[model samples]
Target: MNGQPQWQPISMLPVFTDMIDGMLESSLEQLQNMQAVKDKPHVLDDSILGRVIALYSEQLQNHGAFQEQFNRWKKTGLCATDLAEVERLIQQLAKLKTANETILGIAKSISHATIDKIMAMDDAELAVAFLSGKLKRPI
Candidate 1:
C-alpha cells in the first residue's frame, strides 16, 4: 500500500470547512470562557483542561489559515498541492484526537467528585461559571 493519502474530491471541501469551522467556534467560545474568570486555576492543577483548551486554541488558529486555503480551493477546485495540505491538516487533527480524548477521560475521572458540586450548584451559578469558564474540573 502507498504511504501517502489519496486526493480528496472537490465536493468534500465544504464538508471539511464546515467541520473545521464548528471546531474553531467551539474552541474560541471555550477560550473566551476561560478568560472571563480571573481567579480560576486553569493551568496550575493536574487537570488537563488548560492543556486541552490550549490545544483547541492552537487548532483554531491553524483552522483559520486552513480556512483561507479552503476558500482558495473552493474558487479553483482541489489541486495536488491542496490535497496534500488537506491531508496534512487531517493528520494534525488526528494528533489532536488523542488530546481531546485525554480531556474527556480526565473529566470522566473527576465526574464523581464534581457530581456533588454540580448537584449543589444553582442553575444561575452553574451557568455563570460555565459561560465565563470559571468552572474548573473538580478534583
Candidate 2:
C-alpha cells in the first residue's frame, strides 16, 4: 500500500465536541449577564454592550463552521459513535439557539428604550446627553 495507511484518518468528533461545549458555556454566561440587565438596558456599560455584539458575531461564525465540519464528517462515513456525538452537539446547539434569541430580545428592548429616551429629548437636551456620554453613537 506504498507508505499510505490502509485505514482512514482519525475522526475529529472529539475536537468538535469540545469546541461546542466551550461555545455553549460562553453562550450561557452571556445569557445570564444579559438577563441581569434586561430590565434596565441603560445600566449596561460600553464593554458589556461590545461583548454582546462580539458574542453574536462569534455565534454566527461558529454556526457556519459547524455546518462545514458536519458536512465533511458525513462524507467520511459516520459510525454509531459519530451519530451519538452529532446528536449531543445538536442538543447543545439548540440550547445555544435559545440563549441567542433571548440575548437578542434583550438587546432589542434596550434599543427601543434608548430610542424612546432620545425621542423625548429636545435638540439641546440631545446635545448635552451626547456630550455627557449619556448617549452613545451607533456602532
Candidate 3:
C-alpha cells in the first residue's frame, strides 16, 4: 500500500482525552466567569475574552486533525482491539464536537448582545439566556 496513509495507535496519545476535556472545561469556566460579571454593563476585557476564543479555535483545529487521522486510518484497517478503542474514541469525539458547537454558539450569541441588553436582564434570568435558545432577544 504505497502512498496510502499509515495507521498509528493514535488513541493512545496522552493528550487525546485531556485536550478534549480541557476545552470543555475551559468553556464552562468562561461561561461561569461571564455570569459572575453579568451585571457589569461596561466591562469587556479583550484579553480575557480572547483566551477562551483562542482555546476554542485550537480545540476545533485539533478535532479536525483527529478526524482527518481517523478517516485516513479507516482505509488502513485496525486490529480488533484497536478497532474497538477507535470506535469508542470516535463516539467520544462526536460528543465533544457537539459540545464545542454548543459552546461556540453560546459565545456567538452573546457577542451580538450589547452590555446594556445584558445588564437589563433580571437576576432570576440566567445570564446565559442572552445566548441560549431558552430566551428570545427582546425587540
Candidate 4:
C-alpha cells in the first residue's frame, strides 16, 4: 500500500545488508574479470552479463529504497549500529558504481545517449531494457 512504511524490521536489516553486500561483491568480481579479459579475443558471455545486469539492477533498487527508508528512520532516531550498517551499504554501493563505470569504459559499445537513458532508468525499466536486448555485448 502507498501508506505502508517501506522500511524492513530492524532485526532483518543485517540480513538484507549482507545479501546486498554479497551481490555487489560478486558483481564487482565478475566485472573485474571481464575487464581483465577485455583485450583477449574471447566472446562475451550473455548469461554472465545478464546476471551482472540483474544483480546491479537489484542493488540499485535496494540501495535507493534502503536509503529512503533510512532517512525516515533517522528522523525517528537510530542507534549507532544501524547508522553504521547504512553507512557500510552506502560505501559498497559506491564501489559498485566505480566497477560499473570501469566496465562501461571497457565495453565502449554503449552510446552517450543510451548511457544517459540507462542512467535515468529505474530497476524495472533496466530489466526490461536488458530483456528486450537493448543492452548487448561488445565490451
Candidate 5:
C-alpha cells in the first residue's frame, strides 16, 4: 500500500563454493603447521612434548569435521554426523523454514484483510469515502 512490497529471502544455494574449499584448506594447513612445530621437541629434549602434540593433533583433526558438516548441510539441508544429530538438525531446520513461511503468509494475509475491512463499510460510509476521492482503484 505504500511502495513496493518488502523483499522476501529466497532459498538461494550458496554462490561461492570456492569459499568453503578455501576455508577448510586454510584451516587444515594451519593445523599441520602447528602440529609440525609441536612435534619438533619430541624423542629428544622431551617425550611429554610429543605426547602433548599427539593429543593436540587429535583435536585439530576435528576441524575437518566442520568441513564435512558444511558438505552435509549443502547436500541435504541438514548437517548432522550421527543419526541423532541428523534428526535434531533436520527438525530444527524444518521448524526454522516453517516459521519463515508462516511470517510471510501473515504479512500477505494482513494486506488482504486491510482491504477487506475498507470495502466492508456501510453504504453511507462508502458513499462519503467515494465522494471524497478516498476510495482506492480496483487493480
Candidate 6:
C-alpha cells in the first residue's frame, strides 16, 4: 500500500475536494454495474434492493458534503459539549467500515487539517483548542 499522506493543514480543502471526487468516480462505476443488472427484468424484491443501494450511495455522497461543510464551520470553534459529541462520534465510527455518520463526524474534525493534529494533542489541549474557536469547521 502507499504510505500515508504528508501533513498539510492548509491543503485540507483541496484534499477533501479530491477525495470526494475520487469517491464519486468510484461510486459511479459501481452504480453503473448495478444499473446494468436493473436493466434486466426483476421482481419487486430485486428492485427494492437496487433502490436501497442507490439510497446508500446517495447517503455516502451526502456525508462527504457534510464533512466538507463541517470543516468550514469548525473554524468557528466548538463548545465543550459539541466537542464531546464529536469525540463520541469519532469513537463509534472507528469500529465500523460502513458507519458513515460516525466517519463523517471524525472526518469533519480533521477536514481542515490532518489526522496528526488530533493525534498530537493531549485531551486537555484538544478540548481547550476546540472550545476556544481556534479550530475550523470542515465540510
Candidate of highest TM-score: 2
Q: Name the TM-score of candidate 2.
A: 0.64
Q: Residue 15 of candidate 3: its Cα lDDT?
A: 60
Error of 3 at 16 (Å): 3.4
Residue pairs clashing in model 3 are none
Q: lDDT per residue, candidate 1, 1-139, as tens digits?
A: 1233344456676667566546645644544544433233333333455455456545534544554554455466567876776665565455444444444444444432344555667899887777775575433
Q: What residue pairs are clashing in model 1?
A: none
lDDT of 4 at 68: 70
* Model 3 C-alpha lDDT per residue in residues 1-139, reported as the tens digit of each score: 1244344465554465565556556666666666654444235444445565566666666776677666665556677766665566676677767666665555555553445545666866655675565444443
Q: Show pairs that collide, candidate 4.
A: 107-139
Sort by TM-score, top down from the best: 2, 4, 3, 1, 6, 5
Return whichever of 1 and 6 wins on TM-score: 1
- Output the lDDT of residue 85, model 5: 50
Determine which window of 10 residues in candidate 3 has minimal summed lDDT. 37-46
Give the winner by lDDT: 2
Model 6, runs deviating above 4 Å: 1-44, 90-139
TM-score of each: 0.37, 0.64, 0.54, 0.57, 0.25, 0.33
Candidate 4 has a TM-score of 0.57
Candidate 6, residues 1-139, lDDT tens digits: the string is 0233233343354454455455555545545544443323222143354454455545655553444444443564667765554444333323222444333343333333334554567889777866885543332
Q: Please list the C-alpha lDDT of all candidates, in the order they appear.
A: 0.52, 0.68, 0.58, 0.60, 0.40, 0.45
Model 6 TM: 0.33
Q: Between the candidate structures 3 and 5, which one is better when assessed by lDDT? A: 3
Of the candidates numbered 2 and 5, which has the greater TM-score value? 2
Tell me how candidate 2 scores on lDDT. Answer: 0.68
* lDDT rank order: 2, 4, 3, 1, 6, 5
Evaluated at residue 122, the lDDT of candidate 6 is 88
RMSD of 2: 8.8
Write the residue-wise lDDT of candidate 4 on 75-133 in tens digits. Answer: 65568988787677767767766676666555444331234455667889777866886
lDDT tens digits, residue span 27-124, model 2: 78988888877666666655566677767756755664565556556667678888777777877877877787778777655763354566778999
